[model samples]
Every structure is written in C-alpha cells, then in structure tokens.
Target: MQDKTTLYSLRKTIGILGLALPILLLVTHQDLLSSMSHYYYTAGGVFFILILSAFGLILLNYRGYPKQEGESFSDRLITTVAGICILVTVLIPTKSENPLGTLFFTDYPYLFGHESNGFLGAIHLLSAASFFFLLGYMSFYKFVLNHDASASKNRLFRRSGIIVWASVGALIIIFAIEKILKINMDEVFPAYTFWLEWVAVYAFAVAWLVKGKIHKDFEKMIKTFQTEKSLKKH
Candidate 1:
C-alpha cells in the first residue's frame, strides 16, 4: 500500500510538472512566439503526450480492480464526444490547406493570413469552440452539479474546481491587461497564449486526479454492497 501511495504521488507530481514546464519555458523564452504556428503545434503534441501518459498511469493503478456491475453510460458518452472533438481539431489542421499551411507545416506562406475561406478553416474554428464548450460544461457537471457536500469523496472535486477556475481567471485577467493596457507581455514571453492555455489543461488534470479518487470510493461502495449481500445469503 505504501508503494502504491508513492507511485500515485509520483504520477501526480509528473502530471503537474508536465503542465508547468512548458508554460515556464514559453514565458521565459518569449522569442519563440515569433514562430507562433510552430509553438502551437509543439504545444498540442505535448498536451496529447502528457494526457496519454496520465491515462497509462491511471490504467496501471486500476489494474485488477473489480469492474462496476453496470457501465457508466453517461461517462462513456461524454468521453466519446470529447474524443471526437479532439480528433476534429487535429484532422482540421492536417486536411485544411489554410490551417495545415499555417499550423502544421510552415513550408508554405499563409495565403489567407489567418483568415481562410477554406472548409477546413471553418471546421478548425468550430472544433476549437466546441472543444472549449464541452470541457467547460463537463467540468461544471462533474465538479458542481453531481457533487455531494456530505461525502468526503467530493472534497477533491471541490478543490480541483477552485484551482482550475482560479487559474483560468488569472489567464483571463492577463489577456484583459494585454488588451486594455496595451501591455504586450508576448514580446517578453514567447508563446504566452500557449502557456496560458495550459492553466486550463492543468485544471483538467487536477480534476481528473480528483475524479480518480472518487472512483475508488465508488468502487469500495460497490464491494461493500456485494459483501453485504453475500453475508445475508449465508
């Protein structure tokens, strides 16, 4: 059990650092933002890689855990929708000449100058909007609507939401300052937006960690139910 605890602690630390290092590098090395397109592509790659690594840790930890009797249909559905939204975001860059030329491969000039009439351009914008909406909605639902105040399992959810929202608020404040005060921090910190975006990502990761804890509690509840039934039958 101590070993398991240590492993989880390590995973959480890595997850936090994975979200932080990229931002720190971007902020400290703002010159990199001159190549914004490349920075975004690199950031996206890093995001996906980190997500997969986190998932792998989760799978390892849950190995041999008993499955719930019934499938969580809502969870599965939302996950599928989120996955599709992410796929659309990726495919749009690969297929559309506009996004492809600007974001994916910089071999050619951005003919549209970030405003393309191409089908893929529209798809890309739509995908991004949808991605944000879905995440926001899902986060609200999981951390707010379904939260049980009396349950100790819900503490993580509450704390994760607070952290994620606080980070998001900070990012928004920074953006407002840049726009209103004409303070271009980008000159000093390349890829500022990319790094700022990670706050939201980091929030999601923390939320996932909390969710994992709640899931374990749910699993325990299921086991207790099963045990009670078995004892009654004896």
Candidate 2:
C-alpha cells in the first residue's frame, strides 16, 4: 500500500509538472511571438501543446520499480550526477543572455538576442547535453536492460526499458532532423523541439523520486552477478 501511494505521488508530481511547463512558458513568454518575428504563432502554439502532452504521458505511466538489496554504489553516484545535470539544464540559461536579465535589461533583443558568456554559458550547454545523455542511458538501463532477470521477483520492472529506449530514439531522431534541415529550430520546431527533449528529463526526475526502489533493484542485480561469479569459481 505504501509503495502504491509513493508511485501515485510520483505520477501526480510528474503529470503536474508536464502540464504546467507548457502553460508557464506560454504565459510568461507570450512575448516570444513578437520577439521571434520570423516564425508563425502556430509553431509556438504547437510546441506548447506538445509539452503538455508529454507530461500527460508521464502522469499516465508512473509505475516505478520496487526496492532490492545489494545495489552498487556507482549506480547511486551516476544517478546523482545525472540528476544534477538535468536540474542545471532546466534552470540555467542556454545562451549568454539570462532570462532574468530581461526584467531589468528591457533594451535587450526581443528574441534569440541574448548571448551567454564565459564558463557559465559553457557549463549550461555541457550540463544540458550531459543531462540528455545521462537520462537516456539510465532510462535505457532501468526500463529496457534490467527489466527482467531469472531470479527477480518484481514484474513491474519488465518492459519499462523498451518505453525509455523508444522515447530516447524519438528524441535523437528529432534532434538529427532539426540539425540536418537547419530548420531554424527556435522558429521551426517551436519552444525547444516540441518539448520532446524534456521527456528524458522528466523520466530522470521520476527515477530520482523513486531512488530508493531503484537502488534496491540495482543492489539485487549486483548480488545476482556476484552469486553467479562465486558459483563459477566453485
């Protein structure tokens, strides 16, 4: 019952965020319409819709893994790193110009005009990319790679990897197309590639929220590996 409650909470949280992201962007950045003069409002509108849809999907599918014993320390460390990356990417500025600055720097360019500077900008970009990669890898591992084992009792972990991998693949393909076509991603795709890029982000966030269960699962896998190793030594 406790596990169910936690899972429900996790799903609710993610769903709310997913639903809110688009709304927040729309409400706060409505000026983007005029700022990015070259693009049609349809682009931004569609992107916002996509963001809400992605979150809705997350809310609908929030069943996390159960706890296991004997997890690896490295798993926890990597998860932490990935979480930080995701946070930074979401909170920090992607370009030289800070969004907050616009409040005071009223004269700033209306769109795509801000230039991020120095290490801060670099860190932001690096963190953003790393966040995506870490998210993809972790989700692939949990939902796809480790979904099933001969000895594991939990069935919820099964088939999850496929979902994560599919989402990752979709993101990669979308990114590639955006780059290849030089679609003026900002104007063409609408608000960060239709918010598809954020799925991995939210997935990772869910992973963190359920870290205890995830850690246990990792530990169990590690113990299983060790047991197999010991048996081989006999």
Candidate 3:
C-alpha cells in the first residue's frame, strides 16, 4: 500500500510539473513575467522558477524506490543529478532583456538578462538541455523497467518510450532544418524553441503519467491504435 501510494504521488508530481512548464505562460498574465525579445518569453522566468521549485520538491520527497538495502543507489543518484540540473537550469534563468516578474527574481537580481555573459548563458542552455535529456532517458529506460505483466503496462511503456525518443528526434530535425535554412531561431520566430520545449515537456508528462497509471483502459486503447496502424500499413 505504501509503495502504491508513493508511486501515485511521484506520478502526480512528474505529471503536473512536466505539464506546468508549458501551460504556465498561457495561464499567466503578461505583466507578471519577463518580456524578452528572443528565445525567452515574457513569462518564462517565473515559469522556470516554478518548475524548478516543483522539481526540487520532487527530488526531496521522492519515495518511488524502496529504501531497504539501498539497492537503488544509482537510481537515487540519477534522480539527484537530474534534480540538480533542474535547479541549475532554473537558477541560471534564460537570456532575457526585460524580466517583469517580481517573485522569481526578488532574491536573484543577476538572473535577469544574464545571457550577455556568455559563460552563464552556456550553463543555462546546457542545463536546460540536460534536464530534459535526462528526463527523456529516464522515461525510456528507467520507468519501463520491472513493469508488471499487464498488457496495458507493456503498451504504456511502448508509447512512452516512443514519445520520448520521437520528441528528441523531432527537436534534432527541427534544429537541423532551421540551420540549413539559415533561420535566426530567436528573431525569425520568437521563442520558437519554446514550442519545441513544450513538445518535449508534454511528451515527458504523458509518458510519466502513463507510468503512474493515469490512463484508464489503456490496454484497449493500445489495441485500437495497433489495429489502426496495421490497417494503414497494409
């Protein structure tokens, strides 16, 4: 019962936090965020901090794995590293020109418009990339392990693994296309990467939620999809 409860909580945390990053902007007022003219958006800073805090809590209160015998030392370490990466990503903040928010940066003045310094910008980019990358890796490799015999479980793993990989692949393809076309990613489409980021975040959320058993009657859903795919293939 305790294990079940922990799994449920972890699933909720991962699902909400993952989905919140993208939706935060839509639900927020423009005046409550930054107004960066580049890859960063008006509300990005506060959103980043919110995600950071949520993920921090996740790592702190995570009870997904059993504590007995400390057999999941590596899992714990990976989660810790992932959590740290999330912190770095959030704390560094993106390169913004006009951060309008107060709550996220009241304590960290240096966070706003810090990308002018190349080193800090690099860290922010690296941390953001790594944060999602690790989540994707965890979705594909870690969550799928030791799943039960339920056909729904197997199908859920397959879907989540495919989504994570597909999202990563799509990002790469989009970047390559943008480079080939000489598109100024920030200027051509302000916060274009934001859309891609949301794609990944949504995929991560869905995958983790499924792992958390968010879907009802997913085995039937899987069968329907499989059947449709087979028909299309033929």
Candidate 4:
C-alpha cells in the first residue's frame, strides 16, 4: 500500500508540473516565443530547463506498476528511453537566431538564428519527436496493459494517446509547410508551436492525473471533512 501511494504521488507531481509549466513560462515572461523551446532564449529559460530536467530524472527512475503475466516490455525500460530523449532535447537547445531575454552561458558558443548549426538542431528536433512518440505509446498501450477494454481509465488513456499523436502530426505538417513554402507562419499566428505543444502536454497531464487516482483522493478528503463537520454539529 505504501509503495502504491508513493507511485501515485509521483504521478500526481508529474501531472501538476506538466499542467503548470506553460502557464508559469507565460507568467514569468509575458512575451511569448515561436515555440516552447524558444523559451530557452527567454527569462523563463531556467524554469524550462528545471522542469524538464525533473521530468527526465523522474521518468528514468520510475518503476511503473509491476508487469502483468506475459507482458513483453517493462514500463521502466520504456520510461528510461523517454527520460534520455527528453534530456537530449534539453541539452541541445532549439535553433534560434534571437535572444528573448538575458541569455545564460555567456561564453558558450551560441546556436542562434538562420546561421545556427544544423546538426545540433536536427538532434534536438529528433530527440523531442522521440520523446513525444514514447509518451503517446505509453498512454495508448502501456497504461492499458492490465485493463479491460471497456474500462473508463483505459478509454481516457486512448483519447490522450490520440491527442498526443494528433498534436505531433500537426506540428510536423506545420514545419513541412513552412520549409517548403519558405514562409514564416509565426507572423500569421504567433507562437503556434507553443499552443500545439501545450495541447499535447495537457493531454499527457490529464491522463496521468487520472491514473494517479487524484479524483479518489479528492473525494476522500471531502468525505473526511464532512464527517468531522457532522461530528462537531452533534
């Protein structure tokens, strides 16, 4: 029971961090960037790195529910891959030409703008894509491994998985269109990547929160409060 509680707590924390990250970035620095990764060039860079680092570390350490009979993959192995990929995204910042705020690593040769190193940017992009794909797989398949097809939570996991993949698809299409047309879509709808990324993260967060049994905890707290109140009245 204690082990289960600890795991639930960890899930809840991950969900809360995911849900709060974008809001925190926007609040800390009102000026939005072209993508969430662009926030690395902003004052919110610290928060961006810190939160993602936390995510990577936690996932690397996470030992998900014990594998049921005949399972092919362990949750820990998949999460470890996701963790490493997310860290790669962090270590290799996205390609950007402009600095959004007081830049960190003053002496570190910067990767910025059109003239930035293509190889590093490619690495970051690939790592990020891999991370999201793994997340989608976990939500769509791994999370439902032990559940009945009609389970409510399984349904939620499937929906979240779809949303994650859909967001990834939209992002890929946008990037392809921009590259082929030599267009800057950010001018038309500023920070489009940030919004789409938020949708994917939000879906992941919601599914995790449900898996953590947050609703049950909330109801239990309410019931305890009501019981105490009734006792006091009598």
RMSD of each: 11.9, 14.8, 9.5, 3.2
> Which pairs of residues clash in candidate 3, taking residues 3 or more apart in a chain or in different chains?
34-42
Local accuracy by lDDT, each model: 0.48, 0.45, 0.62, 0.81
RMSD of 1: 11.9
TM-score of each: 0.46, 0.43, 0.67, 0.88
lDDT tens readout by residue for model 4, 1-234: 138787788788888999999998888778777678877766787788998988899888888966667877678888889999999999898877433333444345544422266898888888888888888888888878754434888999999989999999998999899999998877777778888999999998888788788998999999999999999999
Q: List the residue pairs that clash in candidate 4.
A: 96-113, 97-113
C-alpha lDDT of candidate 4 relative to the true structure: 0.81
Compared with the true structure, what per-residue lDDT tens digits does model 1 show for residues 1-234? 225455445435434554564555355334343222233343344543344344334423432112234524243355446556655554454232222123442445433223344676557545544544444444555434442443554555555555555654655677578879887666666545555556556766665555434456569899999999999999
Better of 2 and 3 by TM-score: 3
What digit string (tens of lDDT, one per residue) describes model 3 on residues 78-109? 66677788777666666654343433333344
Model 3 score (lDDT)? 0.62
- Highest lDDT model number: 4
Candidate 4, poorest ten consecutive residues by summed lDDT? 98-107
Scanning candidate 1 in windows of ten residues, the lowest lDDT window is 94-103
Please report, as a residue range, the 10-residue window in candidate 3 with the lowest summed lDDT. 32-41
Candidate 4 accuracy as TM-score: 0.88
Residues 1-93 of candidate 2 have per-residue lDDT tens digits of 136556546544543554455445546545433121112122343444444344334433443454345534233344456556645543443
